[model samples]
Target: MTKDEFLQFLRDPDVCKEIFEIVKKGGKPAVVAPQVQPQQKFSSIADKLKTVYPNANAPQIQPQPAPQIQPTPQPAQPPKNNAPKGSGSLADKLKFLRGHLDKVREEEQIAAAKAQEKSPAEKYTVISNRRCPICEKDTRVVKTKSRINVEKRDLDYCIHYKDFDPYLYTVLTCEHCGFAAEEKKFSGAWPNKLKETLREFLKQNDMKFPFVEERNAEDALSLFELAILFSEMTDQSKGRQAILNLNAAWVCRCEGFADRERDFMEQAAVDFEVALENERWPINGISDDMATYLCAAIYFLINEYDKSTTWLGRIMNNANLRATAPKLFEQARDMWQDIKRANKA
Candidate 1:
């Protein structure tokens, strides 16, 4: 109420006793309903407490606002991702970007390595248009600019190369009609009768060509075999067929196909004898003397010593061989000596 009224009430013994009980309770200070007193009258709180508890031995009870139990000061927690700006989202974004950049770099390295690994033969080839006689379609003819190093030339005309072999690409494959032949024959003139036979043969079968540009040893051999089939239907010279088979056999040897190599060599031998008897001399760039020599070489290679010696005897006995072609005579003489030695051994 009024300050004068409050002072009169504090003077009463029961009110003063109640306030004293609250202040004297155990533990920290206990708060009671605060009675407003005039500042001028209640200047010293100790004087009032002493006045209230007069004669009894009372503990000094000073008026104090209740002790404020402030919550404990806790240290701030760091972000789980250890972000600079204390944000996990920014850290996650940076991690994703770094991973993406690494993947990009890996793909680029693979691309560069593939480019570097391209074939060496691609640089030395000359591309020219060649018309296929069988199919009447255009096939690209790829030939080497020049011959590579000649390591050795064998009797059956297989020239071993110290570098890339152009013989592997000698066969021109027509992608349209599956007609494959040597670069010269593939583009050269063909008889109308042979063309008609091939046309009839093509009508009965389905064939597709699936190669271009670069060819592995295996694919080139496959093309050679395909050309052999096409060669038979086209009435290509037996000598020419024998040469094709010999070249294919050489390729087989290089590729480690021993069984197929021997088989082709045997076919070449049979065809060579037929070509010599039935066809004319200088057949398919091979002279009659050369054909006889190849027949001997083929028989020798296949271990047909009887046929080999019989064919070799012809070249050895021919009186005009030394005068016309001394090199053939020399090779023939050397081969005969070798065959006699082989048979004796």
Candidate 2:
């Protein structure tokens, strides 16, 4: 039976008692088996008794007493003039104000805690043998200390300090060789002066220094180093800028617009090829190898098929790089295959 019908049957005490008796005797109710026709509705006490005692032949049904129903009294209406106006009662207003005050106090505590946790200025030691700018002695090497202005809104002065203000500057002197150099304190922006210094260093060295190459190559390498240092120093903004600079260099390499683009390409190919000699296509992180793939793609686009195939093979063989950039690697593979097929044809 449906739940509603069963519930209605339960509401009737006579029907419930009859069903219980049938269950006690291990007999199915008459309503459940329609093959045995019922003379009257099971809800009726006489019908229920006959159904319960089917073999009794002279069963008498006693009517069950109905439950007494108490009459409900209506409440008296409240007077409209007795109600107070203005939003709500004073108790509710005070409770709301208390909650708001608590929230404010909690926020203030958090702000205060964060303020208290402010990091002291990072100290960087100048390790190179460059002459001391101040003492002129070769043994004045010391640790330079400078605080990062975390609240600086401008991007220019946020990463590294461009201006050489001595107050913001932290000087370190070396004890051994007495080599000293001024490192501009970093906030969030790349120091303008340091970038200028790097640019000048590139120019003075004719871009042929140990780590320097073409413009993009030098920029990429320098930025990558800076990013690594900043990341280690807990300077996230500077680290992010370095990554952006690296990505820009990659784009410039792909577009062939960067100064010394061809030189950078040749150098990069050589680096990757050398890395492949060790059976490690990446030799770095996955993202770094992905940049290598872009370099390979540029070579492929320029009809340097041999170099393209070499780099593409490296990507295909490297399990980590392959997993990270599967789709890009697959495209490179298909392109390489097509080029080979064309050559054979």
Candidate 3:
């Protein structure tokens, strides 16, 4: 019991009477060991002799060893899907990719105005050289430093910073081959098929990814486009597509581009839903419950109340979900209530 509970127990009249009666009987504490039993007291030479001479105890029946289990031969796993799923080849997709540089230039002036005091690189970000996985060429990559002051976090998992937008450095681009992707996926080993596909994609499209010591908002936008384009053209997992779109939405939100942000959010919701319905479990390292919540949250953000409620209903109707994931269950329930209030309004 806790200290407060013990104090309360001592203060009770009936408990005090019981304690006095226990003391009057001179009873030992519960921790004190009981006297030994008679059966375990067989320490004599006769007992040792009886163990050696098995005939003295009984006719011996030897114990048999447990049977061993041979491992069954398993079927070979299926090869991963690597075929292109986009509308056209990588070159065609690149030709149609949205530049959105008009909005980028608008935001550029705002950022430039702010940078007159102090630039983001002077305090928040640092540059380092890393070998590009696809190109095998060394290129400059931007990295964020710690202790960034947070302004707020939205329910959709977007973080707003007070001083600088750290996500501007999210994507790393190679200057030589024009290959661009997120930093985490930039260096890890890729399947030979995928590596060949990327090399071919770069070769097919005459693109150039020039080095940028300090990434402006437009550079960040272009990197995201390339990453998402790469993912789609290579038929990467739907979950990864959702993540890129979601992050792109946040980046657009940082630039105050509401329409583009909504467009990205809509894509994010669709990709997450596709991942849940058709793709495998533990989609892109995210739990099914979290992906579900993301779909619901994104729908809510886009004012699709019916879709949001439908996804949230799945969580609320699940009896085992509350016990298995209490925190997520509560979040879902709260969102359900918020949807109710929103509908009423």
Candidate 4:
């Protein structure tokens, strides 16, 4: 509608009255609808209401363009794991690496501790090649003490030591044929009958070699028993058997087996008597003086004081023995005194 016509319509009393009623009924919507009348006009009704209610206190209502409803943004999807086939998450991978590193460190520590704990005997040994008499196979043996500290002697003259005792490892056993013998008798020639018997015995029995590595008192006794067995098979001198039995008794003594020790000592005394009557002097490893001294010692041990005194008297009378073996003579004299004192008591 033209502005002049709209102004002329406002001058009409009836039109003005009707427009006032619509403005009063329409409230804020009617009052503010033609807010853009300064820039662009609304509908005729809006113009009529604006003209009727041209007061500043009238509330201005905006359309707000239907609140421009923005579509609610969906949460972003997590990226797919495109890692390698065997690869895991960062946390899992770290856990695995930590465990592996801990295991490696533990192994290294154990190895270092084991190396540190190794004894001088285990670390450094005097390795010697000695051929076995029966098998002839060259076997490695720890001969002398790599670390030696010879202390006191036992009652039976067995030398005690602070380091590795060479006596404990005196027997050499062949790995092939399992022929075990004393170091002194290791090279001794065996008869054909003995060899055949040994072969048959080995075929029948599966013997465990306890003397291959570190030997205890029991292992030493076992070696002595093996030596005695080998000696018997080869028809060795009674002197060798007596000495072996004596050594076995000493080993039993060390292991605190009193009954076994006594049994072996008694067997040694019997063998020594057989050696004195039947076998020749200086038979096997025992010399004539050693045999005599051993006889005296054995008699004293067995409570045969008269026999001991007789052997001791023989040692005292032999000037050559006294001069040649001063230590043996001295030991025999001391033992003789012990025998006399025991007799008197």
lDDT of 3 by residue, 3-57 (tens): 9866875676544554554464455321223454555554644543334333333
RMSD of each: 19.6, 22.1, 33.7, 22.6
Q: All candidates' lDDT scores?
A: 0.77, 0.46, 0.78, 0.72
lDDT of 2 by residue, 67-172 (tens): 8989889699776552334656577667777887899999999999988863322223223343433223344222333543333221111132322211222223
Candidate 3: Cα lDDT at 159: 94
Specify the poorest-scoring 10-residue window by lDDT in model 4: 26-35
How many clashes (backbone atoms < 3 Å, residues ≥3 apart in a chain or on different chains) does model 3 have?
0
**Which ten contiguous residues of candidate 3 have the minimum total lDDT?**
51-60
Superposed by TM-score, candidate 3 places the C-alpha of residue 12 at a distance from the truth, in angstroms, of: 99
Residue 53 displacement (Å), model 2: 99
Q: Residues 1-345, candidate 4, lDDT per residue (tens digit)? A: 689977877777655655565665643333343344465655665555556456533443554777677898889989965333364556677777788789999999999998788574564456678776665677766665546676888545776666555666767677666777777677767676777887788667755373355677777787788888867866777888898888787767656688887888888878887888788878665687788788778778768788778777888999898789999988988887887788789
C-alpha lDDT (0 to 100) for residue 38 of candidate 1: 61
Error of 1 at 162 (Å): 2.0
* Candidate whose TM-score is highest: 1
Model 4, backbone clash pairs (residues 3+ apart or across chains), number: 0
TM-score on alpha carbons, each prediction: 0.64, 0.26, 0.63, 0.60
Lowest summed lDDT across 10 adjacent residues in model 1 is found at 26-35
lDDT of 3 at 35: 52
lDDT of 1: 0.77
